[model samples]
Target: MSSHVKLRKERGTIAECETQVKEIRSQMAEQLKSLDLHVEMRVQLLQDLSEFFRRKAEIETEYSRGLEKLAERFSSRIRNSKEPQHSRKEQDLLSSVSCWHLILNHTRQESREHAVLSDTYSNSMVVRLCHITEDTGRLSKKSKDIGLQMQEQLLKVTSELQTAMKTYNQYHTDSMNAEGKLKEVEKLEERHMGKSADPGLGQSGVDAKQQRSSTLKKMERLKEKRQAKFLENKLKCTKARNDYLLNLAAANAAMNKYYLQDVCSLIECCDLGFHLSLGVTLRLYLSAQSRVQQSQQEAVGVLEGAVQGLDPPGDQKKILEMNHTAFCLPFRFEYQPHEGDQVCVVSAEAQVRNELVTRFQQLQSRLSSVSLETEEVNKTMKATLKALLDSFSFEDFSSSDSLQTSQSAESVKSSGSDPPGNKPNIAKRRANQQETESFYFTKVKEYLSGCSLISKLQAKHDLLKEAIEKAEGIDSDPSRLQCSNRSLRVRKQRPCSQYNHKLFTGDLQQFVESSGQLIPLVVESCIRFINLHGLHHEGIFRVPGSQSEVNEIRNAFERGEDPLTDLTDHNIDSVAGVLKLYFRGLEKPLFPQEKFQELVECVQIENKLERACHIKKVVGCFPQAVLIIMRFLFAFLNHLSQYSDENMMDSHNLAVCFGPTLVAVPLDQDAVSVQPRVNEVVKTIIMFHEKIFPGARELEGPLYEKCMTEEEEYW
Candidate 1:
């Protein structure tokens, strides 16, 4: 049942009504107190929420500021950079520049969005919540005030009722006391009359009668006073009772109104006002957050679309097209005669012969000096090795005179004759000898490296001499000289060929003879190109070139055109591929087919010195042209391999790439079966080119001895 119905059924007497009123008032007061506390708690919650949003706004503002600064910093750097934006060094990054710029733009946009979000949280959400808190708090305070006023009015009525009840009880008690006194006096008078009726003791009776008469008079007066007091007390008590009844009724009515209407209205107002304002404020918060989220979502979608639309190749092509002038082919150099010698026709053949003779003479002098140094170094190394060996044993000193001339030999003989306790000295001497041996080996490597240098110089020397001889031979023949002069004139006038002339698929010897070069022109050109441009290129020989570019370069070379002279349009790999293609298409492999097995067997020898010697012997059987080309090519390869850290093509990798191209196999033999041996032979030749080729006689003692030890370990 409802509280109102229950209160109505429980209301019986004034006391019961008052008791019920007290309980209802107590309950309502507690509820009001609870409502006040709840209001305060809600207000505090709203304050805390506002503080949270305020802090969030601060954090977002800071984050947005940081993002803006970051984007601005990078964009400024990109703008202020001094280097070309699309140079070759930056080509790889050029395609992504637009994407990076897009990211920066979107990041700035996101910063703006966050700034707006911060404003929303600080101005919109927080403001609305504060308003709601204020409204709820004001409503709660007003409701509490109204409830307190009603409660105070009920207390006033209850206090009046208590005072009236006290007055009525006091009056009734005074009236009852008076009535008892009057009744007691009447009983005494009746007892005195009975005594006067008796005959005995006349005088005492007369005295008693007199006393009784006086007492009667006194009793009559007292009765009259008592009767007056009783009537007045009765009237006063009736008035007091009437006032008590009126106050009780008034108190009951006041309490009933308070519990039934006032308290209920106050509680409902507080609850409804607080909840309504809270609901509105929360809805505002949600709406603001949703709007911010929707904005951010749209921004993110746009950013995603931009990110997804990035096209690297298209960007690269566009950049290339825009910078076309930067990539134009450089002009060729033209001959310019001296200012005053325009008509002075110089004999080209005589000029060429003089240049050749000068180079040959220079190389010849260098060879003589280098040969003398090699002999000196060889002598020193042999002496060091012999001293090291002789220090260990005295028996090798065949004569006592030799032992007497050597300190180490004398020490060995003395130690051999000494007691067993002197073996430590002998051991110490042997350790010193071993140390000397190590030093000897170090010098031997130096000597061998010198020999290798001499070999290279010797090769250049021989090439220059041949050119000079060829020039001299042409000069010696009058008929050949006239033909050469006429042909040279026609060649200078001839235009470059446009069609392929089948230069690659020819015999190596034939190409060398036709070009009057120790090595083919194609080989020389490719080697020069790689040396100039691709020595430090990673995976120089292993990485495949673009097939179309390789074919284009190959056709140009086959037409006797110098495609490699201007290499801006070609990559290093393409030129390397052309070189490999020329060798692959050769009519006869550089190493003759019949010699393939012998070379393979020599490479497989167990002793490194013997293996190198045998391989050198077999390589010696090749023609002079072949030897010259091998020296040229392997010399270039050895130099190139020194840059293995950058190019990643060491001797092993080069051998693997060129083994099949340079070495020939018999038809009866499976190329796959002997493939490992072929690569081994080529690797050995490249590594031991200084040893295998006859350049310096210094390879006999210490050089070959060190080779036997160190190269054995290397193999």
Candidate 2:
């Protein structure tokens, strides 16, 4: 019984201990709950961060793609364009095609860098962040599971302890009740034993005694049963108390372990690891960004270097060097007037006289105006200089101004109210000097401009005066008239003067009759040689031959030598130049001046077939010799135009080269003003040679056979 009582007393202390442990379990569970919430928030944050990086990477990739496309589009345009990339006048930085190409290249490089950055963000930064989020979530779930399990374990032990305590209390109450019933039964029996025996009524007393004995037996039996019951209950109470105490100790130990080690470990793993991993992931992201920025900086540096390296002059020089042949100067118009026309002769002389007089009067007027302007500028410059000089003391203004000006500057410095080192006075003097110098320079610039203008006018005046004197001399000289008539008399007299060479500048009919061929030998030989060797030559007639070589070939032809027979020793350009020079030196152009307007008007017809017919009719009006040569030359030109890709001389280019030479205009007409029409006529002739000259024979076989037959007939 005493053990049972002591057990019950210890049970209350154990329950108190369990209650304290339960409080610890609650604290540990709350801590774990808070930790789980923090981990969840952190995971969400990391997920958001990963998504942000992913979006940024996507944007960067898209931007990079756009930049690449922009670069490629411009690059393709530059590559495919036929026009020159740079203009001759655009001689500044960034004007070269190379600079533009470099800029495109830089853009492409930048795109590549951006693409790399995108890749880094996607593959390195974003991926790392996602991995961190995954790991943090995984670890947080694991920690939360462990924490819940620990709390459940503690709570389960605590529930078992409570049930054990309840069983112990119930057993203890039954044992105490059984003990009280036994004590009550024993007190009743003692009272019965203490009662005296009364023999008053023998029979009643006997019956009473028997009843009291039976009662005593029953009471004793009940007392014995109660005592046994009390012992059993006390044993059960002790066992229950022991179980409750054991469970209480277990719960307490579990709670202590959870709060002390398990909970701390869970918090450490979840909270510290989460923070550390997050920081590492963020650092990795920053590193990736830094690498991207570094790469961007490198790209920018390279772009800046390319920009700094731009050299417009060097690029222009390189372009010129590469395309020098294509830059050959075009042919100039050579004036070739027609002969044997009295009306043309009178009109030419009158035109020359009027032109010379008009030019002389204009030059005289310009020279006077320039001279007066120059005088005014000189006077203004002198007045400005004199005014500047009079501000200082000088004995001789012309020679001593510089010295006196220096002295005056020193004197002003010494006489100033401020000290010698006064900065304000110095600045004021500098400003005044700058103003004075600016005024002087302005006057000097005006004077120099006036001088340049006067000098140019004087040169024009001199040239005009010389032209007037020469024109007057020609008008007064009888020799000029003889020279003018020399071409007409050349057929009868056959003058051999240098100016009247029989083979060159001679009558085309005379040459044909003399050579006993339909075409002159010079024209035939030049055309045959060019057809054999120079047809595919670049720039053919557009690029002129050396003057000395051309003159030598011309002299040989004029001297009646067949210089073109062995053209292996001659340049193709010189041979072509000889042909052009022969036509330009002709006393009459292939197209006569009298029919020039009619030919031009025919070319103006809007319809192509009608224009060709009209031009053919007008061309047929020429002498047979003219018609045959025109047919031969145009046929050859049409052949040359077929190789226009190689020679760079199509019908238009060839016509520009030969228009002024093959066609003649009246002296009263400006050759420049009439050149476009002439070029159009020549181009039309070349393009429509077969249609214009319908019966023209093949240049190789039939033409040579016709030439042979004609030569035989002439012989």
Candidate 3:
């Protein structure tokens, strides 16, 4: 029973203890709550204090207004009093009583509120203190964190500063060493002994070397050209020497066979076989005297033969009649003065006239294939006229001549008139004839005048003037006479003014003949010329068709034969030859300036070329304008081709010297105008190129490609 009770008591005690602990914990919670409650009460007190202060400020303002009103009322009363007997103390006492009541009441309110305010301020002060303590802990933590970060940054900056210090020290040492070295080098350079290179010496040496090379090259070229020229000259000299020897032998042979006497005798021969092929021109008049002697001798011989045969054959009378008929036959066939035979020797001799005629043609073929001019040859015909003259002069001396017949008539009457027809034979015939009457060659002398030398020379000049006037014109100047197919120019005997209104005119052949056709006329003119001048006879004379065949043809013309038709059919030609001689061009002009001289020479060369072309064109044209135009076209084209070739040569030279850029080529439009000048420049370049490299040709294809690749420039 005791134990049970004891356990109950213990349990009760334990329960009490446990209750106390719970209450204690509750009490602690209440204490914490009371602390929170104190903070809340403090906050509420602060709020009430602020409210009370605001209300107190308002109460003070009202109290001040009441005091102002009260003072104002008292001052007004005092000032308005009539006697002003109130004591200053009494007024002061009344004003003080009112203030005492207001002060006591204000003091009571303030006392009442001062406790609440004091408590509120005390609580706020305690809370502020606790906040300050918490803030101090927070600032301490921030300071620790900031101090650690700053220390790390400062260590990094210290490392960088150490590197910069090391670099600055090294730079200082280097600067000091460099300054010392600069001073030492300056001293060494000032004491140097070696010489510096000269500026111009190397250039002079190069020029000297170039000059030597050029001289050596020139010597080589000169040697080669000399060899070539020597060989060429030697060949020409050898050919000239052989030609000279051959000509000498031929000339000697010709000289040995010449004889003047045989020529005279041969002229009288009847044989026509002795042709003139020995390459000597025959003088046509050389056979005239021999011919006259032969004819006279033949006549005398015939007379002698007839006399010797005087027995008189069966047909002597008939033969005499035949001889008389034969003598008159010449007169019956005699050529008249017009259209008989006339041919110009000048036109025949022209070179251009020989297109179909070979240059090697015989002289006789060239001159005598044609006859002499008709009017002159017909009127003066030598053989026929001579025959007439001879017959007229000698007939008077013949046995049956008229002069002898008169003598016979007188004698016959004196012999007592013969029986009607009773005439003696030869003896009686002689007895009846009287002495011969005189008739001499004095008749021939009356028909002739002037010496023979003057006459022949006059005839030749007359013939020349006639020919010149007839074939070309009367122009005294050769240059003025240049035209095609012009006929002979024949002038009036006297200038037109001398003939009044009648102009003298005739055909070319007749005009020349009007001067004179008599042999005596020609002979007399020749005689006058001979007396005037002391020229050798052979030196100034030229007779046409001097060969035998030509003479026979001339004799045939005297007997009334027409010759022009035969001549025109057999041998004639037309020619167009330009005169090449120019006196002015031959005397080349001189110029003092070398450049001017060169330019003049160049111009002259060009002019000569053009003139040559013109001359060739004129010759080629002959008698046709179309032919002249064609020739001009071809000639001008040839000149253009030559100009083009020169252009190419210049281009090649330019290409070699100035690279391809400066080649002597002109652009499309510029080419037309500057071609001539460009050609000149190119010509100059080519000359220089040849000077640089003789016998040189253009650069090869690969070389050309390389050169042109440098850069092409258009001029």
- TM-score, candidate 1, is 0.31
Ranking by lDDT: 1, 2, 3
- Which residue window of length 10 is worst by lDDT in model 2? 394-403
**TM-score list, all predictions:** 0.31, 0.32, 0.15
Better of 2 and 3 by lDDT: 2
Candidate order by decreasing TM-score: 2, 1, 3
- Clashes in candidate 2: how many? 0
* lDDT per residue as tens, model 1, 453-482: 465455445444544556566543211212
lDDT of model number 3: 0.29
Q: Which candidate achieves the best lDDT against the true structure? A: 1
Question: What's model 2's lDDT at 505?
Answer: 76
Winner on TM-score between 2 and 3 is 2
Poorly placed runs, candidate 3 (over 4 Å): 1-219, 231-262, 265-303, 306-394, 401-715
Candidate 2 structure quality by residue, lDDT tens digits, 437-484: 455555554554455445434544554455456657654321121223
Error of 1 at 308 (Å): 41
Each candidate: how many clashes? 0, 0, 27
Best candidate, TM-score: 2
